[model samples]
Target: MKKKTTADIIENNKISDGIYSLRLKTELSNGILPGQFIGVYTENSSRILPRPISICEADEDKKELRVVYRVSGKGTGDIAAMKAGDKVHILGILGNGYDLECLKDKKNIVIMAGGIGIPPMLGLAKEIAKEFGGDNDKQISAVLGYRNSDTFLMKEFEKYCKVYVATDDGSLGYSGNVIDAMREHKLTPDIIFACGPLPMLRGVKSCAQVADIPAYISLEERMACGVGACLGCVCKTVKKDAHSNVNNARICTDGPVFLAAEVDI
Candidate 1:
């Protein structure tokens, strides 16, 4: 992890009323992998510490990272207030990214992402397409779900592979949740990558467990320090060792990325 000044804010536009995407200039974004996030300081004062926001998009060529966030709380509201030239501090390219090595030579890859969970999947899809010879032999499908069509990021995924959208309000391709869309699509995937609410992730885990397909999931939890020290985002895993029999691993450090079955979810 590294501390860096936010050199520029390219875009602070609203994706929706409560959700906004910020494209900021920062060299810390370079070499970032999928599933890694940045800890951004919402306020200049030390009163409010940095908040972890997932790295939604990164332009290595431009040395910038983009984060999409919802105005659900005060810190985020302040971040939403940021302008094109505002300076901010960030610690980033942190946490364990998805195991890209796992996708090597896979013939079929399927991604199930809901809500903001689709962020990493966007990166994953691009990696998969590029890794497997441009999505020709390796088929890629994204079962993207949102509250409504406007919230879906299918347009981003469409450039990489086929996309199926499922919205609860019946404003998209399929009426129902993402799992329903997955079932309806009847995808026979070699591997599944997913991120979403716990219930949704749990459902994905249970489904993958039964289907005997390997899956990787990105988890969301509150954090104090974006690094390991805080012990704030502890996730219970079955793995146990002598010193730490509790298996209460730090999400900010140990993960943010875990095998589907390893996490309690």
Candidate 2:
């Protein structure tokens, strides 16, 4: 039942190849947590649906929201054209974010992310670090993946967590994927949080199951309606949904983030 609002664009600049950093000033930052996303309505009338992008950071005090996204197609291309001082219509504070309940009584944590899925983890780590209250005993490590040496947000994450990188071309930290980097690093954690492509998430789920570590993951589904009403982004679940009596869940509402064991992956 949320209404769309026009927000002022503070900055819109390309940070890396095919990627952009968009900053917006809006009070809708309230109720938005790490792992939640917003739907940005593009200027083109032909592209009616708003493009949903995971929030990179949200500052309640500044009333600012940071979104880092890839210029994937025409819709996103339109978004890239937007500039500072422009007005954009966005609807959100959407999706149930990463559940912090699984973090209680846990100390060591590992965050796994690949490609554009890496943005949400930055916000997640920031919150985790805050919740830990500067307790140095708590170690938060980020295992990230990239196609090559051109990595984004490396400095921001390095500020909060120990960063390890994996590149497909052997152009960076680890030569293989995130899973290989994790094994090589021999990371032992009490809990995990991940966001990435399906294959990458499947790997993380398997790792969590075999190690008996609690893990939560966000599904990067291509969505039409950013709300559950569309049913365009349902994912398979282990249990039947109470409303539909089917073993499925809408990624938009039920979660873009869920316990590793809760969904089939």
Candidate 3:
């Protein structure tokens, strides 16, 4: 919950057209958790305020953090223009992130992600692999999908766990979506965690339901106040009771991570 302009960009460049990864040297971001995000301002007084980007990887020793983003609009286009030594304003380790505690001790863990949805999964998988030691026989599997092979971040993820990949254009691992790939493998994981576009999540939820396995989904929404005060990121859930104090929970506060069935994303 701190606003710090105390660092310089170490490196920033195109990982692909409209996709870039930046490394920043910042002490304050060392303890960032997976699925948490940073709100960054491209200009000192830009009219659009700050844009929220997912925290991809963190190295406490070097006090380095990485954020991989897509240039979908003006704000992101500006982010793509940043380079080494640039000074930027960042407020973060913001929002509620995924709970690693819930994942501990599970015999089988499966992680599924799509597109830019892949970043947080990378953080999560890295932690899991570190905890269990990088063993090929480990009961961990990661399912990653992209629009095409050109946008894939495969090598970064394969180092830590068993991986399955899907692409819409048939340029990579499987010719269909991730859900299709999952069906092909018929995997029955003890715990499944996912983050992706809403439609993809919906399909994942159904698959998890049919398998009767627990699933967690990290919701990605357009956030105004990364904190909950602005009431800009409310999400509907099935947990609501007629007498429940709050029917909708703020994604910035109550969760960006929620039980798959509870979230209406």
Candidate 4:
């Protein structure tokens, strides 16, 4: 269930040039899962709608929810200006998160994320590490992509899984896209999970299909209402719904996470 509440900003740190990590103290963190998001209200009263930002980390014991976001517009710009001790209205722990249960039987799992899509994968990696334990045979490989060497969360991700990185410029890891890094490393995972731009997701889907491996993808979309009411964030689906008889799905509610083959992308 989603709740409308005011959350106190405990930490607001800049991660890169235009990126920031905002941590909030709230009771809503209890049930938040990897791949879920929070809708943050902007300070600008003119912009009534809240911006949907993906949850980067959730600490249930600490009652803290962290989100990493870029300043792309007025709403996010307002968010970027917020300081510690500030209070903001948020609605969340929303959306259906990644399906971790399905990956349990698979020994080798790959997590591929691009740009800002990299944050949520951290929580997923942590959960997987905790669930499988040190003696388990499961191996997690995380392939992350960035525009340049100025990146965040690399160290955090490294603590949980085997991390590989790719940058458009040769300043960092492999001097190409994540696909190139995966190829160069010869990574062969039994299942794949990805969250990135459309091109990256499409590439991952294609790769999974060729490899005959199951895959899940988290999508990014512009949303008006974070819930399903507004119908602003719908995507084309591969099949018609049994009830609606339409080949459309809501990105905000029906997913932000879906089987790679289920959506048109």
**Please, what are the lDDT tens digits per residue for candidate 4 over residues 140-215?**
8899999999988999999899999999997899998998799899999899989988999999999998998888
| Candidate 3 lowest-lDDT run of ten | 238-247
Measured on C-alpha atoms, candidate 4 has an lDDT of: 0.90
Off by over 4 Å in 1: 44-47, 133-135, 241-245
TM-score of 2: 0.97
RMSD of 3: 2.4
lDDT of 3 by residue, 219-255 (tens): 8888887767787888888665233356687876666
On the 0 to 100 scale, the lDDT of residue 56 in model 2 is 96
141-224 in candidate 2: lDDT tens per residue?
999999999999988998888999999999999999998899899999779899999999999999999999888999988898
Q: Report the C-alpha displacement of residue 178, candidate 3, in angstroms.
A: 0.7
Please give the lDDT score at residue 95 for candidate 2.
Answer: 88
Q: Tens-digit lDDT track for model 1 on 1-265? A: 4664655788888876578888888888678778888887877464467888888778889988888887778788888999888877787777887877987767788889988788777877776677774546778889998888677356878988889999989987899988889889888888888988888899899888998888888887788877777677888887762345687777877788888878787
User: How close to the true structure is residue 248 of candidate 3, measured as C-alpha lDDT?
Assistant: 82
User: lDDT of model 4 at residue 142?
Assistant: 97
TM-score of each: 0.93, 0.97, 0.92, 0.97
Q: Clashing residue pairs in candidate 1, if any?
A: none
Candidate 2 displacement at residue 228 in angstroms: 0.7
